[model samples]
Target: MPSDARSTDGSDPLDLSGGERFGVWRAARARRRREREEVRRFTAVSRRRRITWIASVGGVLTLAVACIAAAYTPVMAVREIHVEGARLVSSDLIVRDLDGELGTPLPLVDRSAIKAALVKYPLIQSYSVESRPPSTLVVRIVERRPVGVITDGDAFDLVDVAGVVLTSSPRRPDGYPLITFEGGSGSSGFAAAAAVVRSLPTEVLATVDEVTASTVDDVTLTLADSGAVVAWGSSEDSAAKAVALQTLMAAYPPDAVARYDVSSPESVVVDPR
Candidate 1:
């Protein structure tokens, strides 16, 4: 209104005198807003990290529970039992004995029960059990082989090299040599005879008629076809003895020799009938 006089309309006289002060206030407010925005971003990032960690832990727990539950459910139960490598032993009997495992979970199959049931069969020397997931159990058996037979009055006891009685028959079974030794099954004589029998080749063993031993070093045999006697010294050097006997038998047929002395296989002594 008048020269050098302030207006009454609350204007700053259109002047730049307070511009620097207002600029300071505006910069401070902008800085405060920027700090608040940074804090909010940091909080959001931490929250997302916590949510991710919780989700990962929950997933692991859920998977572990699912696996454990599946192990005990019918999905993992045994539905079939199979027997393999059973020759002298009955496969059906072994399968029947292991029937208790059926319907049981594979992971929970009673191994003690299987062992107890398998021990009933003496012919089974060793066995292994395997599980096929989602339903099958396999049992493999190894049976003892009889090397000779012993006379037990009216019955004949088939025995293996270890002197274990495999079975008994009312009548004399063919194809096995008759064993006779003084000291019941534990004598050195029996051991020597059993070793000699075990060392015999498949072809040579088939022709053995009888085995007799009163002492360890006097194990002897008689041929079935020719009735020729074989003087086997002991279990020592049995492989050589077998080879010598087989060679001598080939050179001089059993029909032509009355006795074959393989006690010293290096120099065989053949006596003519």
Candidate 2:
């Protein structure tokens, strides 16, 4: 009989002995390992690219924030301060108080602080402040106007309609009427006196010299030239009082009319000259 081994032919899956098959398997395994190593290298390169991208974006954001912060920091002098509707107050004084922020960040100006400082000035009635982006500060003010004169000892103080004292003059004012009160204390009587003046006719008010109020019910008016006294008595029926005075004066010219009493809105009494 022939040898039991079969003849190796080209038709066989592989023309190799057992040792050759083992060698081929080892070679295939090595190739697969090399390919896996190449894939791992590609993955590592991709992860490195992603990290670099994130770092670059973070760096840009930080730089932007730093630039913005630096820009807002006060590095320049105050360029402009616009003041509007100012009459009684001096713009220089208001600017002086704001000088505290000369080197401070304008974008970060404290609104409350500025307002508190400005309101301290007695002349300023109401004020508003604003900032121009990156540089300027604007202050707007409404000042008190002198409405009447307040009597204090030998001196007289100019006051606003709100009874706030503004300025004092050595003598009585030429335009406004002098206001007097009882107990020699004339501070609180300013508002009441002003109310009486405002309620009177414009023509009558123009000729007023002094306004005396001893009590709530007694309000006396002294004329400018003749020094005539008109008993006004309280602030009620002011329009009617003005009309009665006009009618009385029409009937009897003011040259001879000494005292005109209009305390009662319905009646008019003309005292003998």
Query: What TM-score does each of the candidates earn?
Result: 0.77, 0.60
Q: Candidate 1 — which pairs collide?
A: none
- Score candidate 2 by lDDT: 0.77
Instruction: Give lDDT tens digits, candidate 2, residues 1-273.
Output: 875454465255546898999999999999999999999999999999999999999999999999777757665334666677777687888887777766556666677878878878878888887776556788889887666787776788887777677877788777888877665334445555667787766677788889888776788888888777888887777778778876776787666778889899687788868
| Highest TM-score against the true fold, candidate | 1
Deviation from native of the Cα of residue 5 in model 2, angstroms: 60
Q: For candidate 1, write residues 139-210 as lDDT tens digits.
A: 888888889999888999989988988888998788899999988787788888899999999989999999
C-alpha lDDT of residue 191 in model 1:
88
